[model samples]
Target: MRRDPKSTTVRRTPWPEGAERALGTPLQPSVVYTAADPDALDRIYDDGAPGFTYAREAHPNAEVLAAKIDRLEGAEGGIVLGSGMAAATAVMMGLLKAGDHVIGADQLYGRSLRMLAEDLPRLGIATTLADACDASAIEAAIRSETRLILIEIVSNPTLRVADLERIAALCRERDILLAVDNTFTTPRAIRPFEHGADLVIHSVTKLLAGHSDATLGYVAARDPELRERLRVTAITLGLTASPFDCWLAERGLFTFELRYDRAEENAAALAAHLAGLEGVQVLYPGRSDHPQHDRAAALLGTRFGNMVTFQIEGERDAANALVRAAGQIGFAPTLGDVSTTLSHPATSSHRALTPEARAALGITEGTFRVSVGVEPVETLCAEFEAAIRAAQA
Candidate 1:
């Protein structure tokens, strides 16, 4: 449509529909869009029609991103949220009421534990912590009021692997929802639904986005109705994902498998080198010496993922010295970056946990988690060898 120059200060132009299609996904930042007629507008708003009305409720970039993730994870429906915690909040808020109870893996990410232990209680929801790798322990913790069971496929920092299929079966028998955090083991490894998980969650800020540049989270489910419940909660709570972030994440998604393959290889090589180093204990799911190595092998097959955690022979001073000396790797608390990075649990991820609690979880001041990146394996090992020697000295 054309407007008179005297009557309008701006003109809008669109690509000719039949002429050509761009090879790239266009970045859509518009928060509000128009419809052809009142009925069409109503359909967009009320019927969940095939058009975006607002970025907060629905947007092109997020829709495409969500759909792609749903397919990758074998989900009937999916939604993108503001951050990893936002997706976690959506699951808790959307599924439970005041009297309900939730069971979480004792080794969940510190922020997730904080939400379950502290934040959810404020809403009159109660939570129980269980040894996620032990199916019987989780079953014993379940109560009549239990509404959900949350566990990470590969527990953070310590690399414990939960028996997802076993836990999912228990959730089914008890008529409870099973939500598995697949952040560490991305969908390239396993689809939770095939193991009977009701919901699959991800810190898309991690491997899915493949780059540290994008910060977003995702929730997907085999049940579309359950997904709607989550979507509604995200909308009401203003937890919807940012359109620009979604675009960046989608762009990142295109090369995710490629990036992950290289990163995974580097992680394995780095873990081997770390294992050979003196005065360090390496924790990786792929290592047979790990506590849950058998379970990890059965659950994840060969795609054991890219995170590596190690403990220094000494304490806080040793960890600090290594961080200071590890010039080749960035000292970033967060993970899933393209370049290798290191984080101290006592000071960063698990800092919220009491010193005693941290010690109990095996997260001492000497423990460091590495987010292995798609870099040359030799370069990473050499840097780590120097860092360890300097710290020991």
Candidate 2:
């Protein structure tokens, strides 16, 4: 067994100062590794002495970013994956087995809902969907077979905050592992483990990476045993993050605080502005009107996250028109980028689920998600106002 770089007894060389600056460097995507050099090969994988066995198994780029994330997340270890779904699936599959049950939030990432509703069942894993906002609902959903409880710190599409501390405590009492997706409230805003969550997951593709350039995910666990299991599952399933994508993710992390700082301010200001406007139904974690506003305030404080969603007063066509009208906004599924990106969940991110399923989660056709960027609040407000007016017209 190889020693982790961070292990105190490892006696490893110290990382250079400004090592953090390396994260944002553009990735050299075409770097090739060859096994022909015997000396290099020996150094790379001597008796599993520590370090890369293959690019798939490990990469300096990925490890570097993972290290930073682990620090930010306050976790024993973290594993990066190809996507958020990969991260979720790896954690669940690695930790839970056949006949084991999972209690997951009803308002999870659409792909996650599908994974639980459609895929996990086929594998003989049972799941019960509960409203994460209600700790009692989660408690009720947990069966004797339940081994994992999954919740999102801030749900996707709908910017709702979960009662993670209470729920995590409940899971701990019941001896079940708790996993919270911290995608919306990136580690910079709040570290979920501090609130008792056993494992924290991130769609690095979203806020952690803080750019539209990379597709990556991560799982940070409090316990070393669980973290190792996640890593093993990732290695076996080939759910590893690409070195280049990891590099890009790292780059995104460097400016994460700055980006989110701007985006958060923008989101709050925009949310307030939207709430005051007539006929727009806004959903923002920052607002006191949010369903779990008090809880969000208690946990995340001033940073309620960058995601802001609202519904146009009109129907689906009108909403689609509004999306099209926002010409500066990228009409894509990605989030947490420097450039404001918009997504229509029913058609993009949640397209995998059925209409009924989406409706169940309050994800309507008119629901528009905005990953607030560093754009001036006034500019973004203007774009939104113009789009809404166009949709109404």
Candidate 3:
């Protein structure tokens, strides 16, 4: 007798005998999987066996991608999630309790600052904001209840490089945890784990998935025990990433180093040229005039980074004019793309910040942040110069 047509269509097929293996990891989009024995299913549910029962809890794509990120970061263990913010949320939810205290930089990614200042407090967790660039400021803000100190390696917009070595020592002395948001620097620039950070976090949506298609995030924990807690928390909260997005991110990683190197070199050249513009003031760590030049030189690898910020002279209107004229460089609200793009801090990334806070951080209406990308150096230089002239006109 022949099998029913419905069963024939739905049943999984077996591969041919001695078939060649796929050169790359095949995308597994199966949401729910089965096991032969009921006892085996229970073991998988308990994480006693490395098999997937549910996509949200555990999936092959996420596992493989997480492993690669683990190797890159030199982490004890790691997890992948839906978005960068989800990764940050998982860290706080998994590790922090109601009474635990966290010390974070005021200049962290805008959304993270909002979470520290507003969201976490709702959970009865208290967070203190400090100037992470100043190790003294971070020390002064530390309390006996402080459980973690979180800061970006290179701050957004302003690009202040934190003194990780000093802060890591302080965390060690006080037995406090150190978490570095390394989205900007990535592991390519500096892996925070080697500098004594207990947790290395990244917004994989940006550089790791350099083409700007994937919205993924990662958190690498140095302690095995902590890793399990985070993994469980992420799974329970339904923050796990989709198989397709994880697959895209994996593809992006293959050429990440090449894109990063070229983009960084382009940024250095652009910053140098923009520095000489009549009225613009460039904020690049590679430049001697930058406040954190020495620290960036000491701490960062090869070049400064792919970000270059400059204030357009005159007013916001001048900045607007420049954006209008720079037809080649797309005006985007995001960063870390294959082609160069410009983002406005006052209106986009740092919009949540109040006027006073923005001004204090040197983020003005005229501030133009260029997310320098893997474009030809000569084209970037000429186009940006023309945009400046148009803004002045």
Candidate 4:
């Protein structure tokens, strides 16, 4: 009493004539390798295969995705890591020794700030967090021990766009490496290397993954030496991403343009809408009135990112209520998901920092961060309007 085969779900496709078919199984893609003599294996042992003899060093999935990222970022090479912090850590560890110093933006992702300001110091590496937007501040911060100058394409929380070209020139004059966290402005909107960055990094968990399904990171460099150092360090540290995660991140890459287009649209609209509302302090880089709007527009052009940070009139209680009231929205710290997410930096992403550190970065209690999704702009606006009204009430 077997069920009819026609009743089962099946996808039928026509195969070309003489297409290799025995049991109708698809053939797996093959890789070509050469090991003609015993000397080949010995040479491999001696060379260590460029520091990638283990999957933890370089998985096939990660290589494929890294190649794609290299192309997208316009770099000579790329390496994918388990997380954003891992990527950053690899860069710092590979390029800087105990006596080295790093100059980073005053306003950076909380974890990044911690890594540079607190963690690196423990290892005898010092850091200076200066206003990255000001070329003079960055120039003044450079010291003989300063090996790297790190800046974000767009500042998180503050959403200020840095002048990469100017900074790049400065770093070049001083013979220092310029590493940029291009997480906020993905390559889709801005290519950091073109603007003079020595290395570019991404938290692929965000817009690059678009769906927020994978936690992956990537680092790329145009300079061959820097690329090799980063890759070797990654291999030694064993912080590479898994094949499945790389595959997920690769699939997400296909629709990067489409997802970002829609989300950017929503972000622009929502930014404008929130500006007109009462009892709210909206900070959107896309808006003309924003402090760094011109810089953002110049760097990102017409397509700004899908992140918005605003402060409510009340306190953390009011902010929490607004977040809770927006039950329709995903209330989580993670961003770049297909579904919108809301979070409070003070308590979530930046919570590891002390109160003084958080305040220094302006992660106030009343601040609410939003990652706009592909939901209809009207629906999103309505939800936010209702949430803000609830907060004010």
lDDT of 1 by residue, 1-393 (tens): 886786764656554586678788888888788778899988877886788777788888888899889888988669999999899989999989998999999998999999999999999999999999899999999999999999999988888899788899999999999999999898899999899999889999988997788889999867878988998999999998888899899898899898888989999999999999888899999998889898889988999889999988887788778988997688988888778889887888889999999888888888889999988999999999899998999
| CA error at residue 370 for candidate 2, angstroms | 1.1
C-alpha TM-scores of all predictions: 0.96, 0.89, 0.96, 0.88
Better of 2 and 3 by TM-score: 3
Count of steric clashes across candidates, in order:
0, 1, 0, 0
For residues 97-126, write the lDDT of model 3, one tens digit per residue.
999999998788889989999999999999
| lDDT, residue 210, model 3 | 86
Between candidates 1 and 2, name the one with more favorable lDDT. 1
Off by over 4 Å in 3: 1-7, 15-17
Tell me which residue pairs clash in candidate 4.
none
Candidate 2 segments whose C-alpha is farther than 4 A from its true place:
1-48
lDDT of 1 at 371: 91
Q: Please, what are the lDDT tens digits per residue for candidate 2 over residues 1-393? A: 886778767553544577366434555343445554687678766655454556667777877888988988887668888888889988888998899999889888878888888889999999889998888888888788899988888888897888888898898899999988888888777888888888888888887787678899888888888988988899899897888889888877888888888888899888888777677899997787888888888888877888899987667889778978999888888787888888889888788988897888888878889888898899988888888888888
Model 2 steric clash pairs: 24-251
Q: To one decimal, what is the Cα RMSD in angstroms of model 1 from the true structure? A: 2.1
Model 1: runs farther than 4 Å from truth? 1-7, 10-18
